[model samples]
Target: MNDALGEPQSVLVLGGSSEIALATVNALPRRRLRRIVLAARPSAARDLAVTTLTAEGISGVTAVDFDARSTESHSVFINEIFDAGDIDIVLLAFGVLGDQEAAEADPALAVEIATTNYTGAVSIGLHVARRLRMQGHGSLVVYSSVAGDRARRSNFIYGSTKAGLDAFAQGLGDALHGTGAHVLVVRPGMVRTKMSAGMPEAPMTTDANVVADIVVKSLRRGKETVYAPGPLRFVMAGLKSMPRSVFRKLPR
Candidate 1:
């Protein structure tokens, strides 16, 4: 539940070790935060995240085992958490950026990327929405990407999954209309993170903190969709306007 100031007290992060998700949690008013649940496959990184948050003075920080690809476990996973107490905010931030060339050569690899990003999301996202609607008030932050706005030949395989997730999030938001629950879809360009390491920084590439700031602001203002760095909103608009013939010829 949220505090008197509407600041969230209990938060759930699906991609527990995600830099953007952690940064957003940091950006929130920590004074009101009481419980934090980080759901991810067990790893030293997950343990480190819990320890780091606790060391930083955040209370009730804990981690639970989760696998995004395990769709059958989603219902029980979500039910166990919501049954314990109300969740004020949920961050759906797990995704993968597959190697386009490799994925094209191996259909199985493409299937792995698609199932993790699209099918897993749909399975878990619906369960979360049901719990939120029952509780009557909460926010769900879905991390999409500018890559989803239009597919590029460079990473079209990964981009296609984000596009599917973005569409699903929009439809979910509409389904929750008139219910107190809210959904905020975030589209970020290249973010400088370990997942994106070794890639050349694209125009308007920002860090996790910048994306986190946007998430916090968008949540407060009740925006349905937002772009990280803010300016990329226009950049994407221009990209989308480009004709396919011209768009495909541009540098990767």
Candidate 2:
């Protein structure tokens, strides 16, 4: 449940170790948050997240085992969490940005990306939606990307997965409308994080904290869709409207 100020009191982050997700948690009103659950695969990173939040004086921070690719376990995982109490916010932030050339060379690698990014999201997203609907008040913040707006040749496989995720999230938001549950789809541009480490910076590339700030603001404003740095919306619009031939010739 949210506090009197309309701030979330409990947050469940699906990708516990995600830099952007952790940043969003840090940016929230700590005094209002009672419980913070970091759900990710058991790892040192997961442990570090708990310690980091604890160091920030977030009292009820804890980590739970969660594997995005384990679709069959999602329902049970979600139910167990909700059984403890109501969740005020659920952040679906797990994903993989595989090497484009490697994915192109290995079909198996491409399938892995699709399964983790798209299929797994669908699996857990539905479960989370059901719980939110049952609670009658909450928000689901989905981390989409501008790449989904229009698939480019350089990263079409990853872009395609985000495309499916963005659409699914939109439709889910519609379904949850009037049920007192809302969804915020965050489409961040190139964000500098461990995931994008060593990659060449692209135009409008920003930091995870920048994306986190945008997400927090969007949640406060009850926005359904938002672009980090706020300018990429227009950029993506132009790219989306460009002709395929022209788009194909553009630099990666």
lDDT tens digits, residues 87-183, model 2?
A: 9999999999988899999999999999999999999999999999998999999999998999989999999999999999999999998899999
Q: Number of clashes in every candidate structure?
A: 0, 0
Where in model 2 is the C-alpha error above 4 Å?
none
Off by over 4 Å in 1: none
Full-model lDDT, candidate 1:
0.92
Cα lDDT tens digits for candidate 1, 1-252: 776676888999998888888888888878788899999888787789899889998889999998899999999999999999999999998888888899999999999999989999899899999999999999999999999999999999999999999999999999997799999999999999988999998999999999999999888888999999899999999999999999999999
TM-score of 1: 0.98
Computed on alpha carbons, the lDDT of every model, listed in order, comes to 0.92, 0.92
Clashing pairs in 2: none
| TM-scores of the candidates in the order shown | 0.98, 0.98
